[model samples]
Target: MGEVVFWTIIRTAIVLPLLWVLKSYLNVDLWWTVSIISVYGVIIHPAVIHYRLFNEKNEEIIEDTLCSTCEHFDKTAVLCLKHDEHPTRDYLPCDGIDWSPKSSDKSQNVFDE
Candidate 1:
């Protein structure tokens, strides 16, 4: 996720200045169309593709691990907040000794009543 965001920032930084330089040469209507297409093609599309790939690569770790249900787990980074380590299918940062349910789960039980 961070990688996706970082590269998108890099692409935007590069594309915006180039677009500004092209503005003077192209007619207003043509420039607008080009800007829209370039922004989508260069910036948005690649980000979406990279994000999907990231998710696909991390799918098992995200969905099947004990960290998925733990309070210290950070799904966005797939990190264990308490141990400051990444969790995998066969490995747990705390080895189940320090595991705790997410607060949202408790909240849901209360809300149901």
Candidate 2:
């Protein structure tokens, strides 16, 4: 996830200057249209695909592993906050000793309710 955000920033950093340079040559309306499409095609699309791939790769770990249910588990990063370790389908930071329910139904979900 961090990598996705990192690369998105990198892409934005690259494309933004090119968009500026293109603006000097193209008509304003067409430049804006092209800028939007180029940003989406080059930056947003890859980040989204990378995110999907990252999610797909971690699917089993997220859904089946003991860390998946643990309070210390961070599903976004697949990390154990207390142990500062990444949990996988086969490896648990606490070896199941620290497993607990992830209370998404608590305060964070209050707005939804």
Candidate 3:
């Protein structure tokens, strides 16, 4: 997720300045058309593609792993927030011992009591 965002920012940074430079050379009508197309093709399209690929790559760990349902798990990053580690399908950072169910009501852990 962060990688997707980072690269998107990088692409935007590169594209925006180039577009600004091109604006001075091209007429208003042509610049507007080219700017829209270039923004979509160079910035928006790549970001969307990279985001889809990132989701596809992490889909297994996000859906099939025990960490998916744990409070400490971060689905976007596929990370164990408590342990500050990335969890894989076959590996857990806490080894299930520190696993806590995700609840909207601020559920308490047994150890917290």
Candidate 4:
């Protein structure tokens, strides 16, 4: 996720200046069209693709692993917050000794009710 955002920022940093330079050469209507297309093609599209790939690669670790249900697990980063380590399907940072179940919103709501 951080990698996706980092690369998107890098692409924006690169593309924006080029678009600014092109604005001076092209007419208003053409520049608007080109800028929109360029922004989507260069920045948005690649970011979406990279995010999808990142999710695909981490799907198992995020969904099926024991760490996924732990209170310290961060689904977005697939990291154990307590241990400050990334967990894989085969590896756990705390080795189950420190594992704790994630608190459920539904259970909280029921108790409140």
Best by lDDT: 4
Q: Which predicted model would earn the best TM-score?
A: 4
Residue pairs clashing in model 3 are: none
lDDT of 3 by residue, 1-113 (tens): 99889988998999899999999999999999999998999989999999899889989999888898888999998899999999998899999999878884245554466
Give all candidates' CA lDDT scores.
0.91, 0.88, 0.90, 0.92
How well does candidate 3 score on lDDT at residue 98? 92
lDDT of 4 by residue, 40-109 (tens): 9999999999999999999999999888878899988778999999999899989998987778944776
How much lDDT does candidate 1 score?
A: 0.91
> Comparing candidate 2 with candidate 4, which one achieves the higher lDDT?
4
Runs in model 2 with CA error above 4 Å? 104-113
lDDT ranking from best candidate downward: 4, 1, 3, 2
How close is every model to the real structure, measured as TM-score? 0.89, 0.86, 0.89, 0.91
lDDT of 2 by residue, 1-113 (tens): 88999999999999999999999999999999999999999999999999999999999988888787778888899899989999877788788888766787355667667
Q: What is the C-alpha RMSD of each candidate to the true structure, in Å?
A: 2.1, 4.6, 3.8, 2.7
Ten contiguous residues minimizing lDDT sum, candidate 4: 101-110
What is the alpha-carbon lDDT for the whole of candidate 3? 0.90
lDDT of 1 by residue, 1-113 (tens): 78899999999999999999999999999999999999999999999999999889888988887888889988888889999988888899799999888899878878999
Q: Which ten residues in a row are the worst by lDDT in model 2?
A: 100-109
Q: Once superposed on the true structure, which residue ranges of model 3 sit more than 4 Å away at CA?
A: 104-113
